[model samples]
Target chain A: MTEEIIIAGFGGQGVLSMGKILAYSGIMQDQEVAWMPSYGPEMRGGTANVTVILSDMRISSPILQEFDTAIILNQQSMDKFEKMLKPGGVLIYDPNGITRPPQRTDISIYQVEAVEEATRLKNAKTFNMIVLGAFLKVKPIVKLENVTKGLEKSLPQRHHHLIPMNKDALTRGMELVKQIR
Target chain B: MADYKLMKGNEAIAEAAIRCGCDAYFGYPITPQSEVLETLMARKPWDETGMIVLQAESEVAAINMVYGGAGCGKKVMTSSSSPGISLKQEGISYIAGAELPCLIVNVVRGGPGLGTIQPAQSDYFQSVKGGGHGDYRLIVLAPASVQEMYDFVNLGFELAFKYRNPALILSDGVIGQMMEKVQLGSYKPRLTNEEIVARYGSWATTGKTHDRPRNIITSLDLDPYRQEQFNLKLQKKYREIEEKEVRFEKIACDDAEYLLVAYGSASRICQKAVDLAREKGIKVGLLRPITLFPYPTKAIREMLGQVKGILAVEMSAGQMVEDVRLAVDGKVKVEHFGRMGGVIATPNEVVAALEEKIIKG
Candidate 1:
């Protein structure tokens, strides 16, 4: 199976790191993966996006014009990537700081209150992990055990103690997601 | 045993240099390739394996440092982006003229001047044809994936030393910034001083002894006749390299009626374009040149029998397309399509260009 995914949000919102974690998780499951980030001056404070592809076969074209999934965290991303999704693709987004929601009728849409939930949980950095958990809950493409292994590999050894907290946030995100039809 | 890890292309280049027992790296930080220097500094190979990694004052300084270290028979290297590479062109020419063995990496960005930090293949002519002022050629290796970015470090060094010529890894911003799974090689020990003297003692300036003549390293020849001889010798070496070291890859060519010629990141995109065209029952194939200087002329010429048309795809206006046209020699319909200033052409766009430029032409 192959999944072409685009994760987009503000630069400080862990968009790139979330893609990195997914790429690492794909490696844990012996899948071929490619992570291409939107870089350069635009990444200083502007909207940043990363294209992450996980496939059982060799991946071609890390740069793509279409995607099977679009994980949008901001309205700018939602406005841009909504039309780029496949007809029956999946779009998961957090309903925070978004003025306009996705308008596509063909694709499946889901929402996770990750930012508000992270604030309530008193850990602001686990927002991306929660979103990741919600995506997995909907697709179940990669195993939860592999994701844990991915976190262990991506996060530094000094931050190993924070895994349990992130895991909690992920679980909470999985519960907080609602299918918006 | 192969050790697997996830890493960016620039990070892979740094790690591979250390693993391959590179003696020194003298480079200044530049995007989107600064990670090569950052990762090397963080790893501190000087402490682990006695390798030296230094941030030079400028690109010129870094390339000259490579020249000096190579004169001593050390496996030295340096890396930079397009503009910085332009700054080192004079030194690169000198290195090529002196017949020094070294690896130079240019993770190219968009440019004529201080261009965008996004990826572009505009430096194709500058790399393979000669950006510097000389009739010299660098053994150019174009890597399409992060795995190739890791593997080509050792391969580049091997080729450089074999011919005593400067070798270049012509990467772009896309490969430099992208991350993927790569199987890394095992650690190799640096060559001991005795071993260096034993291997490169004939020409390397390791020190003159009572038993032998002093080895002098210089590209300068005041006499015009001697300079002409030297130029002829360099040309002969290049011809030998072309015959022995031309490397390329072919995909879906067995039943293809059309061909797409590309290299590096552009080639990776063309692989997907080939798939898309095949799905539409368009018999298209891809010819990705791994060694750009050798030009893969023979391979493209061979496609003239089966392929009816050839489309050259790059990130520039049209540089490699000239080489493709020359290879085909008007036997097949040839066309060019690209997006400049760091814009990457997508797979669907490439397919459309093929149909518009080659099929309908």
Candidate 2:
């Protein structure tokens, strides 16, 4: 099985890291994975995106024009990637700061109030984790055990204490997500 | 635990250099490839492996430092993007003239100037056709994946010292920035000074000894006839390399009616294009040149009768297409498809170009 995914949002919204964590999780499951990011000065304050592909076999291309899933965290990303999803694809997004929500009837859409949940938890950094949790709730591609292992691998040793908190955020995200279409 | 780790292509190059026992690295920071220098600094290979890593003030100084290290018969290297690489042309020429063994990595970005920080294969002409002055050719290896990025470091150094000529890893921003699983090789110990004397003492400037005259590392002969003789020797070496070192990969070409020629990042994308076209029942194949300097001319020649047309795909304004045309030699139709200034061509775009430019035309 192959899953081509794009995660996009503002630079500071942890868009790239979420994709990186997903990629590491794929690796934990012995899957072939590739992570390609929109890098450089574009990450300063502008919109940033990353493509993560997980496959059972060799991945053909890290760069792609469309995606099987688009995890969007901001309006800019929602407006840009909503139409790029394949028919019957999944789109998970946070409604915070979004002026226009996704308007595609062909793709399945889900909303996670990750910004509100992170604020309630008093951990702004866990916002992306919540969004990732929401994605897992809609489509359980990777196991939570693998994701925990992935988190341990990607996070530095000094920040190991945050794993439990991130796990909590993910759990809350799964609870908070609701299907819109 | 498995030996595999997820690493960016640039980071793989740095980690591989350390693992391969590279003696030293001298480089300046440049966009899309600055990670090479950053990774080396962070790893502190000097402490771990006694490998020296220095951030030179400028690209020119860095390349000259590479020249000096190579003259000492050390496995040395330097890396930069397009603009910084352009600054090193003169020193590269000097090293090529001196016939020193060293590795240079050009993680190319789009540019005739400081164009963009995005990835592009525009440097194909600059790499294979000799970016530096003179009639010198670098053994250019184009790595399409992160694994190849790691593997080519050892291979590049091997070929450089084997031929006593400079080698280059011609990469682009995509390969440098993208992350993938890579199984690293075993660690190798750095060569000692005594070992260098034993292996390269014939030509390396080790020092004057009673057993031999002082070895001079100079590209300048000053005498016209002597220079001509040296040039002929260089040409002969290049011809030998062309015969022995040409490397490429053929994908799904057994019954292909059309072929796509690409290398580095473009090749990875073309692989997908080949798959997409095949799904539609089009017999398309891909020829990925692993070694760009040798150009895989013979391989293209071999496919002349089988494939009806050839499409040269690059992330430039069609540089390698010239080489493809040369290989085809008017026997069949060959066209070019590309997106300049760092815009990558999609698989659908490539398929469309094949149909429009080759099948229809």
Candidate 3:
């Protein structure tokens, strides 16, 4: 199985980290994975994106033009990535900042009020995790247990205490996801 | 070997250098390659392994420091990107001229000038060819995966010491920045000064021992005849490296009609293109040169009759392809496809180029 995914948003929105955690989870499950970020100028608080490819076999190119899934967290990302999604592909986005929603009819579009939910949960850091949760809920390519282990692997030992909050955010995202036709 | 850990390629190189007994790292930070120094500083190899990690004032100073440390028979290394590497060329030539065994890592970015901080294989010419003005050769290792990024640090040092020549880990921005599961190697202790003398005493500058003449390290030869002799000696050593050190990875080539020749980051994209072309019933293979200087010339020559056409894919505007063409020598169709200035070519694009330029043509 293979999942080519793009997660794009503002720099501080944990876009790169979300991709990293997913890639880490893929490794935890014994899958070959690559997490390639848009480096250099784009990372200076502007649009930041990472292409994460998970496969049972060896991953070839970490860079790709099209992806099976586009996890967008901002309007700019939505605008840039909405057309690059494969037909009948999965598009998951946070509705808080996105103005022009995904208008593709052939592809499956899902909405997660991840920012609002994270605010309600009193943890802004969980915002990406919530979106990640929505992604896992739809894709389920990786098990939730592996995601927790992924967090343990990605996050430093001192920050391990926050894994539970991130888990909760992920779960809330799973519950609040709405598919838009 | 240690268990698998998800790590960036730059971090893998730093970790590998520490584990592989890299005695000193003198480097100046450059974009897309600063993580090497960042990781080393965080690990504080000095406190743990007694490895000297210094942030030099500039790339020129850093490479010169490498030359100085290497002259003492220490396993020293310095890392940089495209522009930074250009500054180090003079010192690299000096090290090569002196036959000082050292490792230089070029996590290459776009070039010509401070072009861009993104990944590009444009430095292939500067790396595999003599970027420094000399007739010297560096055994260049092109690591496509993060594991190789880790593996090559140890391998580069081994080869450098083995050949009494400089070794280069020719990496790019993609491999420098991407994260992958890397199986770390176990730690190897640094060689002591006594051990250095005992092992490399014939040519190393460990100190003047009564047993033999003083080991002097210098690249200067004012006498033109003596310089010519030295140059001829270096050429002989380069020929030896070419004979024994050529390394490459061939995928799906046994039954292929067309071949894709690439190295380092460009090879990764070609691998995917090979698969995609196979799906479309195209017999496309991938040949990845791991050792760029000691190039797999004989191997590509062996594929002369088996492969009908070759497309040398690169992240630059055709640098390594020149070497491939020279290897094939007009035996079969040879062409180049490249994406430069940090623009990465996708698998489909490569396949399309192969079909358009090689197969359809």
lDDT of 2 by residue, B1-361 (tens): 5756888999999999999999999999998999999999999999999999999999999999999999988999999999999999999999999999999999999888999999999998888899888999999999999999999999999999989999999999999999998998989999987788876657887667798887889989899999999999999999999999999999999999999999989999999999999998999999999999888999999999899999999999989999999999999999999999989899889989988999889
Q: Is candidate 1 or candidate 3 better by lDDT?
A: 1
**Docking quality band of candidate 1, CAPRI definitions:** medium
Candidates in descending lDDT order: 1, 2, 3
What residue runs in model 2 are displaced by over 4 Å at the alpha carbon?
none
Error of 2 at B89 (Å): 0.4
Real interface contacts reproduced by model 1, as a fraction: 0.89
- Measured by DockQ, the strongest candidate is 1
Error of 1 at B284 (Å): 0.3
Tens digits of per-residue lDDT, candidate 3, B159-241, equal 99998999999999999999999988788999998887677656777777787877789999899999999999999999999
How large is the interface RMSD of each prediction?
A: 1.6, 1.2, 2.1
For model 3, residues A46-131, the per-residue Cα lDDT tens digits are 99999999999988888787889999988999999999998989999888866788888999989999889878888899899889
Quantify all predictions' global Cα lDDT against the true fold: 0.94, 0.93, 0.91
Error of 1 at A31 (Å): 0.4
